[model samples]
Target: MIAALLQGCGRGETPVHVSQFDAFGIRIDMQLLGAPEQLATEVAEQTAQDFALTSYSLGLEQPGPMQRVNELLATTEPFAAPPALLPLLEQTRDLSERSGYLFNPAVGMLTDLWRPDPVTGKCSEPPDDESIARLVEAAPTLDDISLNGIELLSDNPAVKLDFGAVIRAYAADIAVANMRARGIRGAMIRIGSDLRLMGDRTGQPWRVPVLRGSGGAVLGTLDLRGDMSVVTVGRFQSPCFRNGKEYSRIIDPRTGYPAQGTQVVTVLNSGDAVTAAAAATALFAAGPQQWGQIARQMGISAALLIDDTGHIHLSPAMERHLQIIDRNAQVSVSPAWQDSGPQ
Candidate 1:
């Protein structure tokens, strides 16, 4: 962005420590400005362990606990898991309910039918129409999955768990929490598309960019002044084609179809990346017409939704936060989400 243009703001050594690694099928870029080397190293190790505990990596000889839960849900018997998973399951259920079932972690069956091979990223063919329809009709929500203590069971055999919707965000939370606990002054943790910013660039807020079509153009800037989360959902990541039509990997559990109609949906919230990430996916699937309601229900005041037509809609809270540098974009502020002054 315009980091050089920024004046009157003095941040000490903007992110002196940087680390790059790959995990959970996505790349991770971490920036730490003022943190001890020994502690930073420990934080990195903890982040990876946390991700492994929460992610559902399939097609491996031994799947993680997330995948194991999916296997249990596929069967009739209850699967006993460690108490560590309680928070993950609990939060996912809350997100699913709040989003009106638009955010579903138990969508493993649906995703498996649409996605390519995880390692090679190639698909023989997309799932047939009949199979998709059948799975969509039978897809189970969190209400169908019961959790008691450390045991989780799905009464519906069709239910399968896939934490794709919010895994990265929650993992970022874990990493951020670890860093903060270890006396890190400021850190930016990005897991795939999930972003979490702690502290500022001296006196200025963290400048975050929202991408436009295919992520080539900058839609605007969301300056995060405090601890907050920002996430974007778009069709550009890991696209698949079927019958000469392209589709995003994200699936709308409500319709059992690969979600479209929105070029990108970016969400901002007070302090957690997981909810922001989940809401972005849910709103992206909900489409332009339904994003306002989804944001309201999820208590997200700041959001930007870009339709396939390149029209940008901003919520009241998001309008206050976003400084649009992209004049070429067709932008509009929604009165439904935010109120105009001097009315």
Candidate 2:
């Protein structure tokens, strides 16, 4: 029973309503608002389709532009020169660099080794130590990979774009762009927990539930208005198990291990949902202290981090926007939030 409502003011029209279904492990919902009756259905359908096409990892199955791109990426030899694959390759390269090469080559190896089961789509146990060591030995670094006009290859011939981290956000960006171009004003696009919201809910804020667990029991809620986008990152959203030990899907590209210590982190920004989501994931992987430093350095607007110790850390900007309704919730506003200039 996933439901959302979008109400408009002075228009006297019924608020747009949307419901979601699970598609390829992603939650997809679409609703039309402030659009003419004839166009609403068309817009909704097109938007949903576009979102699915771009966001679904399995969408790589079809033989289309993106498919062609992915195939080239998958089959191309390490250090091969392929001009057609340059854009995506370059993008991947940049992300790796910006992430301090925290986007490590071993991460992909680990992901493949700890591959999710095809049948249940659940993560299986880590592969044999020999396999892991072989992968690690074969892992490529930025130095190994060179991108000159889209032809990418590692000197060692092992590292490559996993696309798992960036693909969802990329799709969200494309979908939002499509919606705006089609004159759709108010919409929420969520691929799994990665979400993007455009405009306000009419004149009011778009309320988002912040849950404590993957089961969706609410911890708190956020009311985002204007052009802001919100992205939540946490272990609770994507749980995995290995030999009966639980692990999160948020892999630390550096250690080829799952991130630990924090429960959930939310980032709000005026940028696209994809950027927000990616940044949030990276920051979460970086952990709390480093995350705070990065957020301050980047001038990030709002950040909320919930640790395993049941402590909540709110950035200065986030405090202005936060309404902590759970009295029993152990929360602490960061000094930055407390000292943030002039309300």
Candidate 3:
């Protein structure tokens, strides 16, 4: 999940404050335009602290609220939900249902099986078929977990909680909200490949380059206006290989295997970072044939998917915003998503 941010030219000599920090296992880049230097620095520092705290609380491997929740879930017993983590769990549960279970966080057991080495960021080998089959048979889902008030319990012990798919984006949304509350309107918050934009960049629309592959050439650029979220999901790093075939890190919960048939999926949502990020992952899992259906279900109008065969598929809304840079690229457009209700 990577997109290049093209900085806008300065106008009227308004100060542009930039800050970079490491959080959630990735680098976070933030920029505030047309704000007083002291205020921008204060907001950036505060947001950085918030990001650090959120990452620590939700960390999967560390001793934190999420880790404690997983422990209690494995016991299949009722326990008090961590106050800080409950809201995120509730939000993702709703997103999972909206995506028709395509963006499930309940597949943590499945994800753990395919977890990459911390240093290499690649799995040495795929999980054994038997192990995958056993978990798939259990069919753990968010539905198996019951949340009532502050209490929670899982009917199936196999259900584990992992928020890696949407945590960065979710945190970015929080940071943005905080910034807005502080009266800072012009800003950009990037957590990993998930980006949140507010207002314009020095009175110019934010220009983002959508890359074809990780460290690969740009496919095109998106000119985003006002507040928006742009997120891309893919196995940007080298995937695990066996028998000369590559395996993606994005797993399909139903099959207990890495999703195939699509190399990358990018989604744009207005003022909703979590949905944008989660929808991209879900669309990737849906692959080429069903991505359109899932995108419509998630209420995502702007999306672009590049299949493994190097064909470009774009939703009608995306085609309008994206300026194609690869002239010879084969492109196909999907019909516009018809929304049934407010998203």
Candidate 4:
């Protein structure tokens, strides 16, 4: 089980409690503010446990219930589904349709092909073209999955379910809800740039910088108010190089290949982190040209995207929220995407 906010309590009055731990194959950072010392310590411990419990239930790290469920479901056997996962599946289905099937969760087989070795913590090389071609031809979708009451089955034998895109964000949603229920005041959660801010940061809006995937350039700063999730999908997070060519870990479900035409995509969600995470990846995969329509279909209010040419684009909604503190002529808003400008 992965632990939460660097173990134990922070000393002194209003001492900021911070935790750093690895979960879901990514390092997660969390900070707590404006909590009583006792509550801070308690929340930290509970946060760790929450991640651990979530991973076990979801079969993210170890052999847990979900793994067993997947094993049975991988074949043609009728298997009873975990009650908790069913709702997530339904949610993914709705999101997949809304994002034009770009936010997929049933492409586990393809993800596995790209996943690094468990021992090395790195992939030795990219998968062969033949392997990728086979998965692409199969083209699995959530539609192929059917549920008879609690029994779940996948008609497509080649299909496998992977929630890499949604798991952390969903967990963040649950954790945020749990904190609110506990009367927790303020918190900042980040799991590999799928960031969520709850309440305020010392009574001030959180100022966040969106970084370029290349040379760590600050594309812009987002001054976010209220509770919101900021999810950025970039090639820098996961990449494997072969023969001087770079490949991203984020594979396009449509082609069973890496998503193209964008350097980085950032998505904002005031409602839920799950949608924010999915939308960022989906919008990036939708590419710079098609992101506008997909963003509208997903009801995304604001986002900033860095294209392959280093051009920055912002949704009309972003202009109202983020003060472009670092444009430097490198970043510009698309008139077509400006909230009140000519479409």
Query: Positional deviation of 25 in candidate 1, in angstroms?
Result: 3.0
Which ranges in model 3 have alpha carbons more than 4 Å from their true place?
A: 1-11, 119-122, 335-343
State the displacement of the C-alpha of residue 310, model 1, in Å, after optimal TM-score superposition. 1.1
Worst 10 residues of 3 by lDDT: 1-10
lDDT of 2 at 273: 59
User: Candidate 1, residues 1-343: lDDT per residue as tens digits?
Assistant: 0011112224544434666666666677776665555566666667666666555442222456556666667787887865656787788789889998888877778888887876777754777888888878886888888877777788888787676677678778887777788887677777665578898765577888888867777877887866889898888877887678888888998778888798788888889888998899899898877888877888788888888888888887787788889888888886555433321
Tell me, by lDDT, which candidate is best: 3
* Residue range 1-343, candidate 3, lDDT tens digits: 2222323335657677888888876788888887776778788888888888888888785677888889899999999988878888888888899898889899898988888787666566778999999998998888999988999999999899888888888888888899989999898887666689999877789998886854277889999878899998876744677668778879898899999888889899987798998899899999888888888878788899988888888887888889999887788885434332333
**Winning model by TM-score:** 3
Q: In candidate 2, where is summed lDDT lowest over 10 consecutive residues? A: 55-64
On residues 1-343, what C-alpha lDDT tens digit does candidate 4 reach at each position? 4343433334544556777776676787888887766787787678777776677677555777776766776796788899878877898888888998888887888888878776776676777889999987887888988999999998887767778777888888788888888888788888866688898776678888777757366656787767899888888876777678777778888888788788888888887888888898788888877887788778786887888887888887776666665646366666545443332
Q: Write down the TM-score for model 4.
A: 0.88
Misplaced by over 4 Å in model 1 are 1-15, 52-62, 335-343
For each candidate, the alpha-carbon lDDT, in order, equals 0.75, 0.62, 0.83, 0.77
Candidate no. 2 TM-score = 0.79
